[model samples]
Target: MSFCNPIPIRLKEARKKAKLSQKALGVRIGVDESSASPRMNQYEKGKHTPDIGTLKALADELSVPLSYFFCEDDISAELAVNLNKLSLSDKQKVLEITARLIDESKKG
Candidate 1:
């Protein structure tokens, strides 16, 4: 079965979260200023897909993890973004907390 590509949705969300216009984000990610707006517009509209290198550039520029673009669910995607904001210690704490939650849920 073909799952709908989530990039477009998540890209738009990330772009908006960064308060960037399509042209601005495109330019920041190294697309030429002349074609930036149209190119980013196409990606957000799902008419075109950016390659992995471009996506990596985008994730870096947008301050999100590259893996966030490919998450299968919104909750996981949002969690990835939030987790990216944590320090290493905080992330380990989150991991411990989540594992405890999972174990508790399994026991019930």
Candidate 2:
């Protein structure tokens, strides 16, 4: 079955988390200031999808990884944000811990 698109929701969440207005985010990503709000609103509403390059710019401006936009679930999305803040070594540690947790869950 096909799944609903999650990019719109993720974009809105990241924008709000960054404490930015749609107009402000649009301007930061190089949209015309006058049309910024409407353009950003369209993206958030799923009326328009940005190209890959534009999506990358948005992800950078929002301080999230490009993969964050593709996350399929809220929990994974939130985890992505937190994971992005960790050092490489710390990230590896988290991966190890999560792997063990998964294995334990499978055994239970």
Candidate 3:
């Protein structure tokens, strides 16, 4: 069996996490419903890569930042999700906390 590419793996995981079937995600992103299933299947199989516009649409429809797709690790992806859920004030607080943690790590 062919090893899955990271993009395809991430796409499938995010789609499932959002509780969308491939056809559902395709239609939500404005693909014609008739072709949605095959189109999304192609994407998830790494047979096709969506252009940036389509990628942005997918990200928006899935309620995730586009950066989530490019993250190299699950931790980074999870961090992106958590950070995206924060309000501006809360984001700043998170940054401050992260900075403090980094400083503490350096000291210890």
Candidate 4:
């Protein structure tokens, strides 16, 4: 019901879409798997909030942009639709080219 609630809901949605349990996601982000479940539960229930670093780590682990959590619009659905518009082969080619360009840019 509050603005803060959307962040956890979006995180839960992203984690589920990625087929990751809280423990698995926590592990990916270097948190203890044992504690992750309850922590995520708190997050979802809005009993606790994650700091910026944890949110960033969660976004990275979920392979989503941090903006995915903050955007008031349905950016994830839009991204999904855009990705669906791309052919699988074209997607791979684009990723490869983009990676090379990023690497070159980093070197410059």
Candidate 3 per-residue C-alpha lDDT over 8-97 given as tens digits, one digit per residue, 9 for 90 to 100: 777888999999999999999999999999999999998999898998999899988888888878999889988999999999999999
Cα lDDT, all candidates: 0.95, 0.96, 0.90, 0.77
Candidate 2 local Cα displacement, residue 84, angstroms: 0.4
- Which stretches of candidate 3 lie above 4 Å from their native place? 1-5
| Local error of candidate 4 at residue 74 (angstroms) | 2.5
Worst 10 residues of 3 by lDDT: 1-10
Please say which candidate is ahead in TM-score: 2 or 4: 2
Tens digit of lDDT per residue, candidate 4, span 1-103? 7554577777888889899887788778887878978888787667888898999899777777676666555765456435546789988987899799999
lDDT of 2 by residue, 2-105 (tens): 99789999999999999999999999999999999999999999999999999999999999988899999999998988999999999999999999999999
Q: Per-prediction TM-score, please? A: 0.90, 0.91, 0.86, 0.64
Q: Which digits, one per residue and each the tens of the lDDT, describe model 1 over residues 1-108?
A: 999899998899999999999999999988999999999999999999999999999999999999999998999998999999999999999999999999999999
Can you give the lDDT of residue 53 in candidate 4?
Answer: 95
Q: What's the lDDT for candidate 3?
A: 0.90
> Which window of ten consecutive residues has the lowest lDDT sum in model 4?
76-85
Best model number under TM-score: 2
Ranking by lDDT: 2, 1, 3, 4
**Candidate 2 Cα errors over 4 Å, as ranges:** none
Q: How high is the lDDT of residue 87 in model 2?
A: 100
